[model samples]
Target: MTLDPEDSKLITLARAARARNEAAEGAAVRDETGRTYSATNIALESLTLSAVQVAAAMAVSSGARSLEAAALVTAGEGPSAADTAVTGELGAGALHVAGPDGVLRS
Candidate 1:
């Protein structure tokens, strides 16, 4: 499937985050203002957060009231229910799924 340039950019950012951090998953979100935030999954002893959760938190902390879209890069089947829930709470209309290789799945 064809993706918009902006959506493609999100995939690129997410893929890079996963590779750079060597994390299980990476996620990126575009805010209503066109700002983008990206993060990798956090699995520390004291804290565990999905990539999408981290990305959404970053956007919220940075004054993003709502999200336009979100992207998740993972080798797993797809984003988990919790991942999609976070994006939904932030008002994201779409959640793009991609593999670690940066191929868009949905």
Candidate 2:
């Protein structure tokens, strides 16, 4: 798979967030204005959230009205339904999935 520079950058940011948090997953998203948000999964005794959701929330909180693209770096199968929903609501055509090594998955 070929990634544009922006997508590649998103993957890099997601991977770095995962490594820094030592979490199960990491995700990044770019807003309509080209600002980016990245985050690792949030896990707690009472609540758990996927990295994609957290990244989306960050973008919303930061005043982004629409999404340009989204990427998730994980060992799991693919983006979850909730992840897809968030991207969809923000106007992303699709969610990009990549492995920890930065390889785009099928």
Find the candidate with the highest TM-score and give its number. Answer: 1
Find the 10 residues in a row with the least total lDDT in model 2: 93-102
Write one digit per residue (lDDT tens) for candidate 2, span 35-74.
Answer: 9999999999997999999999999999999999999999
Give the alpha carbon lDDT tens digit for every residue of 24-98 in model 1: 999999999999999999999999999999999999999999999999999999998999899998899899999
What TM-score goes with each of the models? 0.97, 0.96
What lDDT does model 2 reach?
0.92
Per-residue error for 88 in candidate 2, Å, reads 0.5
Model 1 score (lDDT):
0.95
**How does residue 100 of candidate 2 score in lDDT?**
88
lDDT leader: 1
